[model samples]
Target chain A: MIRMRDLRKDFSVRVPAGRLRREKRLVSAVDGVSLTIEPGEMVGYIGPNGAGKSTTLKMLTGVLSPTSGEVSVFGLTPVPQRTRLALRIGVVFGQRSQLWWDLPLRESFRLLRHVYQVPPAEHEQRLRRCREMLDLDAFLDTPVRQLSLGQRMRGEITAALLHGPKVLFLDEPTIGLDVVSKQAVRSFLAELGATGAVTVVLTTHDLADIERLCDRLVVIDHGRVVHDGTIEALHARYGSRRSLVVDLDSPLPAGFVLPGTSVAGVEADGHRVTFALDETSAAAAVAGLVAVASVRDLSVVEPDIEDVVARLYRAG
Target chain B: MAETGETWAGETWAGGTRAGAIRAYAALVGGKWRSMLSYRASFAAELLSNVGATVLDVTTVFVLFRATATVGGFTLAEAILMTGLTAFGFVLADLTVGNIDDLKRYVRTGQLDTMLTRPLPVLPQLVFTDLPLRKLLRLVFGAAVYGVALAVNDVPWTAGRVLLAAVAPLGAGLFFGAIFVLTASFAFWWVESGEIGNGFTYGGRDFTSYPITVYAHWFRDLFAYALGFGFVSYQPALALLGRADPLGLPAWAGFVAPLVALPAVAVATLAWRTGIRHYRSTGS
Candidate 1:
């Protein structure tokens, strides 16, 4: 359904220097990356910030013309064939609202009907199906801004798919959502992928999003694809442990052992501690921390693929 | 064709019909109008400001005519007609590029990517989506003033003369719209387009408001042959009043509306397409 050969996108950025001088620099956002996505496959494109994940998606959707590359969506060059390719694909940008901000959700759907030229009957059917699947009818009349983030995201997803696109490209579909909203989006995507109707390409920084929704994982960094495999393979090779940073009110004893985790690191003052825990042990570790007398600040940091890539670079 | 309600099985056009495209544009406009409607106070304020600006422009011309028998050989009534025509020219230009102020925002905030992903062509969606619908009032107001000006001036009524007066500015407005398109296209390359575009869209409108004879010969030629603002009001008014062209243009130059404006629009369209072809969207 999609193919990219040696895709490269270079951006010129200006940097201010000294009092009154600026430097022009060309930064390669996507460099010599190649990819092929088949129909009915859900692939998660993961990378650290500025790691070319969004750039690749933009090229696939024909939003950006690559500096030096060959890109074909449904066998047509994406840049020249962007408009035609657009008909076959739908994209959801997580950070931005694609629906009209002030209009009701149903109004946006109606606009999409004209935009994609869906027959009215087909549009109604699609809307009914989407509303049922996403539980959208509850707030159908609400303006997009009035809805919660999760509702708005669901609205965007429905709008993107109303045209029945062959491929769905999502950039961060679950950012800034409450736990329940995140779970809803994850389940929705999983169900959508299970139906085997449309191929899905998702780019997100969140690891749990990848773990739940993706059948295949493609990791990119510094403008190149670093890993292309299954989640198990990523876990096996760079199987990461989660870190829980806890600041104690006072120094810890020399031989203290955390209940469910092993000590990962400690700051100069023994009050700062990092505990490494597996996914299942997270709740127990937090419970262990609750038992401790005094804690200043506590945060659970997810597994970061950038660090995994960096560790590999250092070892190589 | 593929079965309905199924994901496209293969490559095919998505709603490529002109009717569908027009429907999409109307929806886009309707969406923008509703968005503006949400801010009713802002819309009302903007409408009042535009009407105030028009009134002030009329007062400037009226005060000048009051002080002298004729400024640049234009009678009081002729000057008022020029005011009406110039204002209409602006209204026409704004129809296409009224919301161009949003173009810069779209670029900076990456909304352009959202637009490009749609099945519809990007240019029409961008051009028509956020048009300032409130500005249409200025045109109606201008037309009313034009009728009063023609009546007060007591110019002999002829079909050719009245037709020229109406059609000429429409063409000129298209020409100004062409400039708006050009400036938006330039934004794709330069990334800062508002100031530069204003020089043409706003500056050109201001320059053409008065009689071309009010300016020195060099300035008049620059704005006429060089920038194409002359066709907006000066040439058409001259032809309507049956006065000779003082700038050495052909006596039939007032009818050259299509000759000048159409090509300008064509060039602007070409520039816009090129800009899109090489478009490097802001940060990834």
Candidate 2:
């Protein structure tokens, strides 16, 4: 389990006062945030840029000490017992690599085995699992520098899991991956989550990553968690409405509108229109539209998570 | 089951034990050595260049000796002893833990974050990861020079002298190693302090390469006595040579090289701890 109570971190920065003078100012990156993560729970931690997401991760991983508050992972204090804590937690920073640049991918894994002191049997089992699941056999002998970004990400994920850490923290794991590579990574994480042997906390700008992998979502803004619950709960809280797109047989007269729906967009050809539906079922909305006009084709589009999150940020 | 595994794995990991630390260092250093050798051509070329550089340093000392019968009241033979001690200590440190001066680069590149996440001491992790096995030739050359210096001096061997001879070079290595760590730690607070740190680590090596009497009075007082570089080579050389200090210090001061290292080691350890505590990792 991971527990944090009133955790905070403040950094003193220097900004130029004028041409030759500078002054010091204290900036609170994480401010009095309290959170609890249970074992086997995969939570998606999302926030806007500069929302103290990285700061909170750093404190939990023992990379940075909190200015004030209590933080514990499996009952061990992070900062004072970092080395001990490191044995139980694995962290992957997507922007930074933890592998040796000049060595072959296989060699980096071997060295990490020694660093983590994993038993040979356990190490081989994990390595085999990772190789088969992540398709790492293709580039096992290739130097890390020569691997493409997608290949390197797969190798990184493998490295983090080789130690069998109880908790895994991923920051922007799919930041720049292409479509197919992103799917591979997402599916691999989903499989890992299914095992229920490792607690995973991941932060990403890709909401698709969350929707596909995480069951619970935590949204942070301005150093505070503005919302925490299931995706449906978030949609309900923000009044996120589904939209209906209708391809009509002909154009409707100007100012002729559906009784229970609002017009979201209309195609230039006037043959297609989108309506925002509230509480009304897609069946009812389509029926009402069909009664008013001849419908050629129709579909319902789920609420955009990006739009809901934007509204939540505005409300916060 | 996972909770039990966490506690059990933490116990077996050996990160908190002496044996564990040793195994970790060996793995890192061994990996780095192999990594360097993988580029056979580059490793061979770097080895030759390293030997050439070591040869040049010795040639410069010989060239200076040709200009005068004595430098600062010490003969060629005696001065060579001082050079040998200084070179041995500095090279020992340089080839092993000297790469720590690259702390600024690590901090800038975020490699330090990767290291901190590991279950090992950060200083040793950084040192062993970049261990310069290519400089093994320099260490050999330094020991050879010290050997020749011992033969030419032809000083009568006493029990105490033999002990000092063996212990002094090691003490000097420890002293310079502490200097390397202390200077490199300046990067934590001031990222641009690289050049300033070099002025102490490398500059201290050059300053201690000659007799303290060779420098101007005030300069010698500040760098030699005040900063403790005097005990690194010159004072220890005087003890081995059994010569009185022309500057009027007690002869026993030469024997205190190891003793002098204790304080430098303590201070460096303290500075390193403070620096690690104050580390504000780069923004993502």
Candidate 3:
């Protein structure tokens, strides 16, 4: 559904001095990034601050043009003919809304329907479906400005999807939502992807959002993609290290070492110990710890998505 | 479904300029108008403030005329007419282009990204987003004042003169509006310089409210040639008042007010397109 090759975006900004002197500087926001997204796939584009995730999304949505290379959305170049591409794509910026602030949610949807030239029958059908799917009927009459953050986000999702776009670009769609609201948004997005009619490119720092809604992941750092693979693949690749916390009933055997494990830290009580084991066997590490300590309590800490991405960047 | 896709693709390639632009602009204006109507008290207060400001300005001009007896070869009645008409033209421009002045805020707050993704021209979308209906009250107040001044001063108002007067204000409004658009186009490159555009728009109005000939030779020529404030108010009023041309362009120049407005709008639009290119490349 989307193809980007050798995509680069640079910004030339003027540096203001005290009175009259000024200088121009160029900062490359996105550099030589190439990506492809398949139809109906939910992909999470994750990166640290200023890692060019938003810039890449903007390029795909035709909000920003690439300094070099090509971007095609559903077989059409986004920059050469952006207005047409807009008709087929829906975008939701988490920090901002596209709805008319003082007007009711229904009015904004009606205006969009007319603007998109949706046939009346199709418009009504889509409106009903979106409202039912998003549970928006209760607040449809309320002004958008009056709606709660969650309600406003639901309204935004409905507004973006009312035209039945083939692809939805959600830039931090769940940024400020509460836990319950985030779950509600995630479930709706999941169902939308299940239908196989819309492709979603979700860019967010919320790793939980990535874990729940995205199957494939693209991790970008410093304007480059450092890792791209399925969530399972990433987990298997970097998530091999395990930490075992062992609490012994009795104190100290001095200088006792376990095979294939290094003691990470020990508690002051001298009965608790932590070990970092290589990616060999969890069973063997637990067995080795059981032989040396009483093992009053045992816990295994597995690697998470956030930790994996952090380690990947650190290694880079 | 294939046929629908084909139709959509065809419309997309054609750019959908006619119905798409019209529908988008109407929706924007309609939504904004509805929002404005929602806050009745604030709306009323805004309208009242506009009326008060208009009255104060007209009164100042009237008092000045009483002291001077005439300004730049124009009688007291003619000066009142000029002030009234210019006031009306300015109010109309404010009503239409008030939102264009707020484009800097859009750029600064990053709201321009939302506008860029829409399937419409950003300028029209920006203009339609906020209509500022409060200024309409000011327009009416200025028109009423102009009417009373013309009646009390015993200036003859024939049907042709009345028609010309009505159309002249619209042409002038368009001319000023074009200037606002051109100025707003600069926000794409120099974000902080949005206020600089205001210097030409509101500043030109404030300067031309008085007789242009009252100024020095260089200032008058600068305003005439460089800024073209004469096309907006001075020369049009010269023809309307049946006075000899001060700048001495030609007898036919006043009749081409609409033509003059067309080019200003065209140039402004060209600047806007160029600005969009800059925005796309720089992302600033």
Candidate 3, residue B157: how far the Cα is off, in Å: 9.4
lDDT of 3 by residue, B1-284 (tens): 33333221212233455876687678778888889889989988998988898889888887887788778877777777667767877887788886687877787777888877777767777878878787778888877866765565643466656766778778777878888888988887777884789888877877767777788888878876676777776666666666667756785566565456778888998998888777742221
TM-score of every prediction relative to native: 0.85, 0.95, 0.89
Interface RMSD of 1: 4.1
User: Which CAPRI category fits model 2?
Assistant: acceptable
For candidate 1, give the docking quality class from DockQ. Answer: acceptable
At residue B246, candidate 3 shows an lDDT of 70
Q: Itemize residue pairs with steric clashes in candidate 3.
A: none
User: What DockQ does candidate 2 score?
Assistant: 0.45
Per-residue CA lDDT of candidate 1, range A1-316, in tens?
7888999999888899888999999999999998888988999988778888888888888888899989988898887888888888889999877898888899999888888888777667667767877899899999898999999999999998887788889998988888988888888788778778778999987878887888898888889887888866765688687789888888777777876678888995888888988544777887877686488888988777557756743443
Instruction: Say which candidate scores most in DockQ.
Output: 2
Question: What are the fnat scores of the candidates, in the order listed?
Answer: 0.57, 0.42, 0.35
Q: Which pairs clash (backbone N, Cα, C closer than 3 Å) in model 2?
A: none
Against the native chain B, what TM-score does each candidate's chain B reach?
0.89, 0.93, 0.84
Q: Which stretches of candidate 3 lie over 4 Å from their true place?
A: A14-22, A236-239, A250-270, A275-279, A284-293, B1-17, B145-167, B280-284
